[model samples]
Target chain A: MSELIKNFTRELPDWKPRVRPVNLDEATEAQLDALKVTPSNTKVSDYVLTLAHDVESLKIRSPLFNAIMYDKGGLKRSERELGAIGASVLNRCIYCNAVHMNRHAQLEKDTSVTDSILADGENAKLSSRDQAIFNFSLKLSSCPPKVGKEDLIGLEEAGLNIEEILDLILSTALFGWANRLMHILGDPVKLENNDS
Target chain B: MDALDTTTLRAAGLKGSLSAAAALQQRANILHLTQKAEAAVLRPKDFGAYNHELRHALAGRICNLNGDQITADQYSGNAGTYADLIDPGNDGGNYDLEQLVNFIDKVATRPSDVTEEDIKTLQKAGVQDPDIVRLSELNSFMAYQIRLIAGLRLFKEYES
Candidate 1:
């Protein structure tokens, strides 16, 4: 009954990921290993399991996702989620936008910040620092070919250190990968509203 | 130690450590594997072949069409022209290949447009179900690399 689950399940899809998602029970060793080490350390996400169809690739992909989204060296978790929200928004991937927005709210223990981003993106009402990072992510996702120096300067001016900036760049880039994969591999489905 | 020159790294907006970073290097290697995967797809498992370059060319052309200049500029030059690449004569540039590439583009730019029919087309074209899985995963990988490279290049100027 949580809002995140409700919203996620409510979203319908015209396509199912792949012709048929990988069956978790029947998956091989590498696929199961990939699932075991994910940050959640549980096979909770149907989206990821769907990706298990290509088990070998998932072995590398799962860890990479964990490394970027979790602590490797820099950026707070909430801020990284901000970068995810940025890319998902630009890609117009509502599923990703919703999930990351919910994660941000959970981590920060503040719903308003997530609300602003889900509502307005880079234009969301936020501190200069938050807005700059969001802008960088949006630009990175939508038109990476055109990302410029001023955008980095803006991040620096907003008080982000080298590591934080690099972290955002990495996270934003990861989401560009993650969001597209999620959109392609599977759709979110809620059990309660199965017929809705 | 420098596997890639500074400009190559910076132009892609990636750091020299791209080759050094385990996660990234793994992806770079994964990208290389697609060449092999497509190569296998193009030829019989172990027989004499008509085209050593045809499959490579088709995938190369897909990179350009999808605007993944990062992949194109690095691996294959932008040599596959639209007319020749699509092979106006070969079933709309080989219906099977065309269908796969078209699906790849839509996956990168607009996922909603992708339907089961896209995969079904490849199935009908003789692509094994397992290979189809690999093909779609590879498509997303290419999209990720392009976006990441573009983002890095965009941010490179300011990083210093």
Candidate 2:
């Protein structure tokens, strides 16, 4: 068995659940529906299968997650990934951080930003816009959510309009939700071959 | 229900501003799904040990810990027997939920610090795995909702 990955990396890690995931064969109709297990679409990640225990939330969360992260016309997709990465980093969700960091790198086609974040965390030197986005997300991810007017000022000054800021907020806050479930219920492990 | 009339937008008090309201409306689908997700977590069809009232209490507790009094009050009004747990100062000793409440509070306030031992502690205390997932969804959703409200309120304030 591979050891749990502790530090954040741009490489996507495999998530191993601590609790028993719902057995697909024995899953209730509700769980199956939430998992969306058509014969042709039977492949589901263990992380998602674990969430299927509470099938109701799982059903609704998927669309909401996609809309917040992938919906066009607001914050850029890569910047939204930055918001997710910021929250994941603060929560020490190695899996969430790794996934979004890779996405951010892919979208931006430059690894320097994620490289700096993986190496230096909140103090990573970034462009002013990236700094504002990262700082606000990190603050919002904390308990009691340490954001203030200056954080908003930082975004506005960094040239984010209200729509972009709202998207940033949604993306950041959404990961506050994701990090808890991902970090608390599982561990990020080395991507083993045969994990297909 | 209007998509804009979600518990999240209401808790944020996101009214009286045309642009803020418009910004939210532009993502109406997300807001609508968010409301649905709230119902699914807060009042699911097959909630096990954590019934609707208990879920509300837990949600209230998480909101309070996150310092969002408005959102906390929204959940606390329905907290009933679990009202006392909304305050961080009061542990769950009175309700035979000391262990469960501790797990909830720790996961809510210090999620990064939560170790596998925390989940093990809950299991040792007789929390079944399914209920554990239910508890986590409630806590996790409340974290998202609270931060959403906080962020909207910040934007509203900035607009004014």
Candidate 3:
């Protein structure tokens, strides 16, 4: 009976696989070349290469990438990832959410905590600073102009410096733009079949 | 950077081009209007009417607003009441002066104190002058969007 209920509640028509302009293999090459670096010597296929390239291209173009990778003057990598994940979740980008969630899990083994954050939001277990970041990201994602002075003050109170705060805002803004692009373009392809 | 170099950069990315910057700035302004529109949260019918009125008001073009004239090719697939006409992807109209000033004042000044009447006052006081109108609209929209985004952050802050 439980099985029947579960099956009954399942989506009537499983989502048909979305067709993409670039094939997995060709996209891999484009992604790798855009990043301007070769993939790891491990037996990486075109898909992996493409994924790396996409990240690399984003690194050069996106303020969000700089915030996550280089701008750790005040916030830790985990905190940055948390904010990013929050934004991705708010934007409803399953690809970005999944990618950042996996990264968070890689940093911390407790997947349930990350899952909870994904389920709820920045209100999930995190420092006040991280909470501030998550809140900021969500606002930026949903209604950008609604972000006001009080929000900046909150981050300042949370101990983020002016530069870090600026980075956070820019990162959030960049992701908002990127999320729109991703939403319009297509679903994010899985880098590996085994990836959760 | 040299003119040639600047041109090259502009070609490479949307952020790099003068036109692209203008587009982004315009988008930021529209986002602000959309926020205000959403806060008011008009019924679908009213929202659609208001969107139609606003587009005609801004563009000076009597568009059908019900997607009558819009073709599939022009569809930008943006999610908004005015998505058909004002979709960032659509190259319909440039920034208007009056709208630009309102957007700017909203950002630099406290919007809470400013009334719609004040906006009208500003508009009447030569806010829509051709000189600096285009640039002002672009700059104001970008600034306003940023500030609005900042304000939204505050809203979320209190929630936290």
Candidate 4:
């Protein structure tokens, strides 16, 4: 049975757009060019299609998004996912949260951390290291962004170098951009046959 | 454009920081892309309803609502005829954009509380689907940019 997923879960949910997605047949040349770079050129999801309404933003955003999350030598992919989850949770973006939570789990090869977060939310018990990363990101994602010197000091004490810290900020803020679009423009639902 | 001249770095006041120089250099590509994104949202070639000037005004408004006057003032220079909307208190009613301004502010500051009704309100106000997406991209980008500046400032404080 397909239903809107109200709470956070590791299970990925399909997204349903509230606005009309651009019809592929009628897409402008620019939109077609932008859509071609989506994760899979063979098939595009409703989310990408909906974003196609603003083709210019979609084109630039894709490369920027990938570089922040997948770039090497700063924060590990798993920790970046944690930053993404922090922003998603603050924004109540169910779809974004679920996607990052699953990725965090896969990268760490452990579900316990994600399980704790799903169960406890802001109070989720974590190692000192994870706690520092998550707390800093949570504050950074807040309205008006409450991050302070102590937060930076906390990260330093937790052993994140400047480069890693910068990457963390970028990933969390990236989701600040993402959750607004995903949560405001659509709903997250579990569908019986939808592949997206 | 010089890496130090990027909006994010300048707004965050990190252009001259000795400690941040190397880290900023390492992430130059992300900074460059971030600049490109600002252009894509604020000054698109095929802008449907929101033009360049109105887009700057709205961007300034979002920055003000988020408590970042520095970035807001930077946007104000290009805000032009719609500059009055940059003040969050104005409500955009002067230009028959009350609904649009309200929606932008809420999405910028309280996105989690936003519901489907919000989008419907914009639609009922005659906002087209593509324009709605455009408004969202603009608002969402502000959220990211504001936080990035805030985070970097904190980093600067630590380094100093």
Question: How much of the true A–B contact set does each candidate keep?
Answer: 0.36, 0.82, 0.07, 0.85
Q: Model 4, residue B63: what's the lDDT?
A: 91
Which candidate number would show the highest lDDT if scored against the true structure? 4
Winner on TM-score between 1 and 2 is 2
Provide the lowest-lDDT 10-residue window in model 3 chain B: B59-68
lDDT of 4 by residue, A36-113 (tens): 944466478999999999999999999999999998899999999999999998889999999999999999999988
Candidate 2 local lDDT, A52-127, one digit each (tens):
9998899888899999999989899999999999999889999999999999999999999999998899889899
Top candidate (DockQ)? 4
**Whole-model lDDT, model 4:** 0.92
Off by over 4 Å in 2: none
Q: Which candidate would rank higher by lDDT, 3 or 4? A: 4
Runs of candidate 4 with Cα error greater than 4 angstroms are A37-42, A194-196
DockQ winner between candidates 3 and 4? 4
Q: CA shift at A139, candidate 1, in angstroms?
A: 1.3
Better of 1 and 4 by DockQ: 4
- Tens digit of per-residue lDDT, candidate 4, span B1-75: 785578998899888798878888899999999999999999999899989999999999999888999999889
DockQ score of the complex predicted as candidate 3: 0.06
Question: Which candidate would rank higher by DockQ, 2 or 3?
Answer: 2
DockQ of 1: 0.29
Sort by lDDT, best first.
4, 2, 1, 3
